[model samples]
Target chain A: GQQVMQIPQYQHVQEGEDFTTYCNSSTTLSNIQWYKQRPGGHPVFLIQLVKSGEVKKQKRLTFQFGEAKKNSSLHITATQTTDVGTYFCAEGGSWGKLQFGAGTQVVVTP
Target chain B: GAGVSQTPSNKVTEKGKYVELRCDPISGHTALYWYRQSLGQGPEFLIYFQGTGAADDSGLPNDRFFAVRPEGSVSTLKIQRTERGDSAVYLCASRIQGASTGELFFGEGSRLTVL
Candidate 1:
């Protein structure tokens, strides 16, 4: 059974603070995807990392893929109240199957 | 429809009852997936359909859980003799042919409560 381990299952951050969550896979992955799910909402695709050592930024959020493509991380700079949600990292496999991590729940207080 | 559509949105059933959850993926999308999310957990894969055929169903928990995509557009997840542990949000997502990018457009999900 393949597993993706995520650290800091829960994180409560003050507004203007930073937050980061890391994900590691037990097996090599072809690519990884990040998703955000607001409380009481469905998951939404955020970004996907395919290349090794790849890094991508979306406004205040930064995503990084390890050189081996076996790990990834997401960092939010100067977190805001709107950033409250669960962040999930998923390893994409063949046939549209996505193995998702348990996810990191982020709570930002003003 | 503009996005994936799920029926009922919420279902409350008694233990041992049979239940059927439906998913209507985005039009023109060739890939559809079913997942279950328990409290405080991420979505777990249940099954994936590539067009009219199920390309992978290894994620299905047991024989009690079954799904079908007969026409490659709409799918139905059937649960027989449901139990309390079956309570969870069943999510459906669609993508363009399961491309390498792996971007998925998801529905709001059907929350199933087994009492």
Candidate 2:
């Protein structure tokens, strides 16, 4: 079984501040997908990184995959109240099974 | 439907009861997945279906849980003799064929509560 570990199980950020969450795997990963779940809501797809050392941006959110493909990071710049949610990183298995990380719950305060 | 749809957004039953949750994936999608998520935790893989066949069910916790996608469209997850531990949010997701690494479209999920 493959698993991903996320750091800073809980994150409290000030409005307009920037923060980063990391996801690491003990084994190499083929692809990594990021998701966000708002309070009392279902998880929604954010982005997916497949290439090594790849980086993608969505508005103020930046997603990066490690050169070794064993780690990934999601950084939110100038966080807003809309950024309040739990961010999850998942590994896309060969047969379409997605194993998700415990997630980093972010809370932004004004 | 435009996105995945799940029925009975919430379910509540006593222990030892039988329950069934249904998932309707996006039309034309060939892959469907079931996951369970407890409060404050991420989604845990449960089963995956490729068309009308169960591609990978190794994630199922035990025999009490079973799922089917007979016509390669709608899927139903059944649980017999449920326990309080079985309480969680049952999430269903779908992915188009050949997009193994693509993002998954998820349903709002069915929250199960066992008393």
Evaluate every candidate with DockQ and list the scores: 0.91, 0.83
Residues B1-115, candidate 2, lDDT per residue (tens digit)? 6989999899999999999999999999999999999998899999999999998998899999999999999999999999999999999999997864578899999999999
lDDT of 1 at B86: 99
What tier of docking accuracy does candidate 2 attain? high
In order, the first chain's TM-score in every candidate is 0.96, 0.97
True contacts kept of each: 0.94, 0.86
Q: Write the per-residue lDDT of candidate 2 for residues A1-110, one digit (tens) a residue.
A: 43999998999999999999999999999999999999999999999999999999999999999999999999999999999999999998777678999999999999
Candidate 1 - CAPRI tier?
high
**Candidate 1 versus the native: TM-score?**
0.97
- Tens-digit lDDT track for model 1 on A1-110? 43798888999999999889999986788899999999999999999999999999999999999998889999999999999999999998787689899999999889
**Pairs of residues clashing in candidate 2:** none
TM-score of chain A of 2: 0.97
Question: In model 2, what lDDT does residue A88 have?
Answer: 98
